[model samples]
Target: MNHEKLITLPCQYPEEAKNSFKKLIFEEAYLLFIVLGTGETVNKILDLATKAAGSNQDPGMVIWITDYTVVSDIIESLNDPLNKLNDLDNTYAFALSIIDKVVDVIKKDENKLDILRIWKSFQLALKG
Candidate 1:
């Protein structure tokens, strides 16, 4: 990632942001998967996602991941007001939006189960 750019709120460069997000989606897939799974990892994931999505003030790319757990319990926890989405920070809103979409998909279908498990395994490898 380019360290030269100091991320603001939403990124202003849509194309650049989209491309950057796409790259991160692939490179950080395992990290993302693991982060989304555990309650402990949520904070770090929120931090990273906030940076990734709020760098400028532009929601350029909708970075999608398929490793999200389909359990409503997990979804509920993420949606809770204490999850930081209710904070005063504008960046948190953008990050929450991305997470909300991810959880939505997981809540919708079982067809993604296999892919979700694969992502979990990939996450574990990265952890080790």
Candidate 2:
């Protein structure tokens, strides 16, 4: 893998991201998975995944993992009327930036990303 640019991964290119994720299981002898989260719970989860994979780390694949739950948690916490980040306009705009990124990613592989949402957070309930 000579294309060593700074990959802020869970890559925008769906095909490449899917390929990179699968390629190592057979090709590389060992795999280490890291799940970055806040504090101890995350620590435990990371320990479970990495330790489960065990020992040989760094096959150079960096995957970015996250969800809307973080943002939704912030909104729920700041439901107070006087909170600075509670401003409707700014919050909506911030949300739209995330939407824009999703739009760009979907343009790459709509079906695959939709399938990703099926396992991740598609929120079909949001429609009704």
Candidate 3:
């Protein structure tokens, strides 16, 4: 990512912001799956998700892994309090969105079982 250029650009860069957001979403979900593994409990997953989402005060792993300063600037530029990526609920929603996309991509393929596993994990995590 072009950190300097992205930071210099004004908040009018919705396309850039959207792209950054999408990348962050996928990164977070991928990391979550890798970190959580198949043996993790729902409560454990929820706890990790909450911590990973961060907040206005705390910087989450997502922000840390993806350039904190740039991600923070992107979130500020978004100016959308309701859908801030740092929020826990938004993090869960992002994970679900990724799961949906994966399911769609593998809907008729041999990875259907993988989709079901992912879906069940998310469902348990969401219910927690």
Top-lDDT structure, candidate number? 3
List the global CA lDDT of all models.
0.32, 0.27, 0.32
Can you write out model 3's per-residue Cα lDDT over 30-87, one digit (the tens) per residue? 3222121122243333344444443434222221122223345443443233342444
RMSD, each candidate, Å? 14.4, 16.3, 15.0
Give the range where candidate 2 is weakest over 10 consecutive residues by summed lDDT.
Answer: 95-104
Q: Write the per-residue lDDT of candidate 2 for residues 26-89, one digit (tens) a residue.
A: 2443221212223444333333333222223333221222322333432344223334333332
Provide the TM-score for each candidate, comma-separated: 0.23, 0.26, 0.22
Candidate 2 lands at a TM-score of 0.26
Error of 3 at 9 (Å): 12
* Steric clashes per prediction: 9, 0, 0
Q: Candidate 2 vs candidate 3: which has greater TM-score?
A: 2
Compose the digit string of candidate 1's lDDT tens values, residues 10-103.
Answer: 2345445444444454443323321223232334433444344323334322232222323223333444343432322121112223233232
Candidate 3: the clashing residue pairs are none
Q: Which ten residues in a row have the lowest lDDT in candidate 1?
A: 87-96
